[model samples]
Target: MKVTVELSSLNKDDDKIFGNIYFEENEYAFPEKGWNDFVIIILNWWAKSILKLLKNISIEEELDFMDGPASVKVQYLKNNSFSLYFILNKEVVYSSEVDVELFTKAFLKELNSLIRNIKENRWESEEIYSLMENYKMLQKCFIP
Candidate 1:
């Protein structure tokens, strides 16, 4: 039960992001083919939802992929476990069960990677700054 993310491309001019989310062997691509979207909003939502899950204050969360018309829904199960569903066009495309601890660790690692990527690319924008801040907050609040 591992989760990882790769932020492959960032369109600074449009503030659109392209990325892949890997849940073990499954890969979910953002902005789904032939479409592009402003992904920062959903990334921020995901980070905040993770915070709530870690704090045990929320049982479920659904995040839309903006113009992509895609989403990932998370349902918290007992004892640090969760069910994850990837939906495209309001249809469930993929689903998996994961351990939150492992997912968080991988998510944090990906966030660090993304931060480095942003700095190396010298992409500066208010939206990127806000996303980084959200990631920082999540890292700070995560216990493991």
Candidate 2:
């Protein structure tokens, strides 16, 4: 509802995004049976999935993603219609308030990208930062 990011990278499989996790955020929960089912599929398959796609979309849950020693927390903000944040360590590294409909669609698209990147062994590359910077332009459209 507030900000977003559109990313581009060399790989066809990547959305190249690095901020504001849409799927984890309650603020952008525009419910649809089809979409919910689709997310469940992705969660069931991704290498390091952060969601379980349970019924009712649990916003109070604190989800964390871990791969060996690395960890990232996906938080649920109760204020401002329940925004979601990605906290790295004790710092809030990424925060996004997305358009409910657009972000959901985008998140689905990006999930595939993430899977592809992970498969290609490039999920944590520098392109993520580039894409994050590129995505900052998204705020301009929504902030006004």
In every candidate, how many clashes are there? 0, 3
Find the 10 residues in a row with the least total lDDT in model 2. 30-39
lDDT of the candidates, in the order given: 0.69, 0.35
Candidate 2 wrongly placed segments (more than 4 Å): 1-54, 68-82, 112-144
Candidate 1's C-alpha runs over 4 A off are 1-8, 14-36
RMSD of 2: 13.6
lDDT of 1 by residue, 1-144 (tens): 444454664455555555554344444443343344454556677778887887778899885665546677889998778788877788888787888877877777877787788789887777778889978877777545
All candidates: TM-score = 0.76, 0.32
lDDT of 2 by residue, 18-114 (tens): 3222233444421211121222222323212222212124444343432112122333344323344545455655555544335434544464464
Best by TM-score: 1
